[model samples]
Each structure stands twice: as structure tokens, then as C-alpha cells.
Target: MKASAFVLLLISGLPAAAIAQPNTAQGELLRRGELTGSRPSAKAQMQAASRPANHASDPAQQHLLQTDINLAQARAEELPNLYERFMATTRDERRTWTAPQWDAAGEVLARLNQRYEQVRTDLPLDDRLRVRSLQGEFHTLRGARNVKEKLE
Candidate 1:
């Protein structure tokens, strides 16, 4: 048993070492171009993005776009429909999303919740219930994706 465990550890360490080395595509710390500096900070990125003078809407330019989930047109009467649309669009796309994409989705979901709060009093009882159910469905999709990735 000891010999077998040693062989297994040896086999595993090779791949782990290879993966640990920094590559061009991904790593904990990526250099900035050929300057040997670290990756641009969030503030640096925002400054770079807002640098274009021809673009008058600086706020619009600064907003991060990750997924296609849009709830801007949602109202009290249309909250359920909007939530359903969000669920449908995100169901398959979340599986392939990276960490940044997931963060963006979470930001959008928080915004949706804010909208719900603004119009909750105006929403009918059944529609409100449906909206809650749709939110639950979105969470379920996230849970399943996590489980699938863990299994893989």
C-alpha cells in the first residue's frame, strides 16, 4: 500500500507542477504585456475605458457587460415575465461562464432584486409568487452547475 501511494503521488505531482507554472492564458498573477508589471487593476481598467472623449456617457461606458440578461424594461406588471426571461437566458449560459461572468450575473441579479423592491407593492399576489419561484429556479440552476463542475 505504501509503494502504491507513493507512485500515485508522483504521478499527480507532475501534472500539478505543470499547471502551477504561469502561462500566457491564465494564472494567479499575469504580467502586463512585456513590462513585467502585474495585470491592470480595476481602477486602471475603468480609467482606460473612460479615456475616450468622444464618448460622452462615462457611466454607461464603465458598466461591465458579461451576460445578456437585461431587466431595464421590467415593471411591476412585467416583473414575472422579466424574471422568466432572465431564467431562460441564463439556464444554459451559466454552465460555460467564467468567474468574472458569474460575478457580473450576480451584480445583475442584485439589480433585479432592487427593481423588485421598488415595485413589490404594486405587483399582484400571484405575479409576486411567480417572481419568487423564478428566482428560486435561477438559484437551482446555479446549484446544479456547481454540482456538475465538482463531479467533473
Candidate 2:
């Protein structure tokens, strides 16, 4: 059994670049360290973390929504480079959960921000909260990028 596993590993490692497509968030996380063979687990955590709260109308909530939007846009711009960094440094045996979470978090922030933006503009709470949330995710992604670099 161990020998077969070794063969599988050897096969998977061959010409990795030729076999792989461009690296995206999902791809990077799935192919990295702890996450390599645990995609289902990583995906579930993301869904739970991103679930909407019950009190959408709260002032603080609104502000978070706005913050999330702006941050998402900015992060989206950096995603290409960020993804490259993740792929270069990450090994199949060292998949990082936080790195995958970073991608999921950014996506959730952006979606929430867009949703809140459609509502009436009079509520400062909404805009402020959204932007803050986005910023939080952006920072998270930035940190993840740094970790990936260090690993490299």
C-alpha cells in the first residue's frame, strides 16, 4: 500500500506545470500543504464563516457591508499576483487552511458589499460596515500572501 501511494505521489509530481492550469484561489489551496487532500473540509469552513447574520439592519452591520465592498474590489485587483505567489511557494504536503479561507473571505465580503450597496443610500451604517468588512478581508488576504511568500 505504501509503495502504491509513493507511485501515486511520483505520478502527480511529474511535469506539474504542464499538467496544471493557471493557478486560482481554489486550485492553490487544494494543491497546497494541509489542504491538498482535504478540499471538502476547507470548503465547509468557508461557507460557515461567510454566512450572513440575522441582524442585517444594525448600524454596525451596515458599516461592515460598505467596508467589505471596497476591500473586495481592491483585493480582486491583486488576486492574480497573489495567486502566483501562493502556487510558487506551497507544496502538496503543506496545504494551509488560512490561505484558502482568505480567498473565501474575500469573495464573501465582495458579495455582501454589493448587496448592501443596492439598498437606500441614506443609511451611513450600511455603507460603513460594508467597507470595514471588505477591509478586514483584504487585510486577511494580504497576510496570507505574506505567509505564502515565507514558505517559498
Candidate 3:
């Protein structure tokens, strides 16, 4: 019954409501807001008008990928080292990271994941396993941190 939980519940039900009650006014609104296939709905303009603009004044918001190293350029051989470095900072310096900072870290993690996808076969078995392990740990820590933050 928490406000956040209630909001989450309402948001989750929107797609179902859109399909289940297409004729209802609420469902009509939801359908208008949804993206249809590769194209947006005809009411996309109206939905866009109702949406608020983003606030990107924070440094973290401006620069989402803030890994110390050039993660985007890291090769397959360096995947383990780069992942280890980022994970270490996430555990240490990033312990106090706000949502925006974590967002940047997530971007870096995603970049690493993309690189891994491209060069996974070229990487040694140990390196591949290490990269995957780091990826899993990153998600686990992020989720745990989110829970901890919510509880606090």
C-alpha cells in the first residue's frame, strides 16, 4: 500500500488495461500513449505535449558513461581488467553514488556488455567467465543497493 508500490502497480497495469478495455476512456488514453511497432501512435503528438522535459543539470546526467578508462574502446583481452576496475570502484568510491551516478555506471556496464558480445569468442575462457561474473555481480549489487536505498 506504499505510495511507490501503488504508483508502480498502476503503471504496470496500463498496457493490460489498454488491451482489455480499448473502448474505455482510460484505456483509450493508455493506447494513445503506447508506441505501436516501429512507429508511434497517431496521438504521439498529444502524448508528447503532456510529457514533461528532462532536467539534466547534474554532471552525472550530462555524462552517463563516466568510467575512468575508455570503456568503449577496451578490447576483448582487456575485458576482465576493465570490468574488475569498474567493479572495484562501484564497491568503493561508488558506494555513495546517487541514482544519476549509478546510471552512468550502468551505461559503462552496458558498454562493456556490448563489447563482450562482439569479442566473446576471441576472449579466453577464464576472461569470458570473469566478464560474465562481473556483469552478474554488477546487477546484483545494483539491485541490493536499490533495495537498501528504498528501505532507508
Query: Which candidate has the highest TM-score of all?
Result: 3
Model 3 quality (TM-score): 0.54
lDDT of 3 by residue, 53-142 (tens): 332243432343333445435567877777787677778755778886777677455445544555666788888778777777877888
The ten-residue window of minimal lDDT in model 3 covers 27-36
lDDT of 2 by residue, 1-152 (tens): 99999999988888884556322333223211222112435664465356443433433223323322232233333333333333333222134536555454344433333332333133465444544444444555556677787999
**How many angstroms is residue 40 displaced in model 3 relative to the true structure, after the best TM-score fit?**
19
Q: Write the per-residue lDDT of candidate 1 for residues 1-152, one digit (tens) a residue.
A: 99999999999899888776444322112111111123545654454344322321223212322233334435578666666665666775776877566555554444455456556668888987887777667667767767887998
lDDT on C-alpha atoms for all candidate structures = 0.53, 0.40, 0.58
Clashes of 2: 26
By TM-score, the candidates rank as 3, 1, 2
**Alpha carbon lDDT at 6, candidate 3:** 94
